[model samples]
Target: MIQITRTIAIDEGELDESFVRSAGPGGQNVNKLSTAVQLRFDVRNSPSLPEGVRSRLERLAGRRLTRDGVIVILAQRFRTQERNREDARERLIALIREAAVPQAPRVVTRTPFSEKRKRRDEKARRSKTKSLRTGPIHHD
Candidate 1:
């Protein structure tokens, strides 16, 4: 079981991993060995996650989430399958942990009166300066 938080624990069976060949840094070994790990988790059907976390995870997963509600994580940073697997699992955990945290409510704030006045004054000053740059108005 993967413990995401004090309240959330996902079963090991929830995760599915597949190995594939990785590109970059491994040289000849990269061509021969399947070092990349593709980890998949079904967000829609997971019994472990809270509904809020599930929604947040779906948003966070973005393009990684399939139409069927599976999150696909590809890990190829390491040159060994074990390392890639670990990396994938760690990434999943991190993502889930992030989703578990509640977002802080945004406070609606108005512009300060002094700041607004200062901006207006600056704009007025700029307009006056630009107006002065023009030649004196002439009446026909």
Candidate 2:
């Protein structure tokens, strides 16, 4: 079981890991070993996540989310499968943890009349300054 957060924990079986050839630095071993780890997690089907978290996760995934609501994370920064696997899992956990947090709704705010007046005053001041400079560059 993987503990994503204090309130959310995922079963170990929920994660799907596949190994593929890494294009990252590995010298000659890059050609022979599959060090890259591709981690897939089904966001739509997972029972571990709350509905709110699932929706947020799908949106947060961006290009990583597939058409079927699967998030594919590729970890190839490391040259070893173990490290790549750990990296992939860590990224997945981080993503899930982020989704678990509820986003505060934005509050609509209006500019105060005084603040607006101040801004207008600054704009008028700058405009007058520029207009004064345009009268003449050469004076006897």
**Candidate 2 structure quality by residue, lDDT tens digits, 1-140:** 89889989999898999999999989999999999999999999999999999999999999999999999999999989999999999999999999999999999999999999999999999999999887557868
Q: Mind giving the per-residue lDDT tens digits that candidate 1 earns over 1-140?
A: 88889999999999999998898469899989999999999999999999999999999999999999999999999888898999999999999999999999999999999999999999999999999999988999
Per-model TM against the reference: 0.91, 0.86
Best prediction by lDDT: 2
lDDT of 1 at 50: 91
Model 1 residue 16 lDDT score:
92
Worst 10 residues of 2 by lDDT: 131-140
Off by over 4 Å in 2: 126-140
TM-score of 2: 0.86
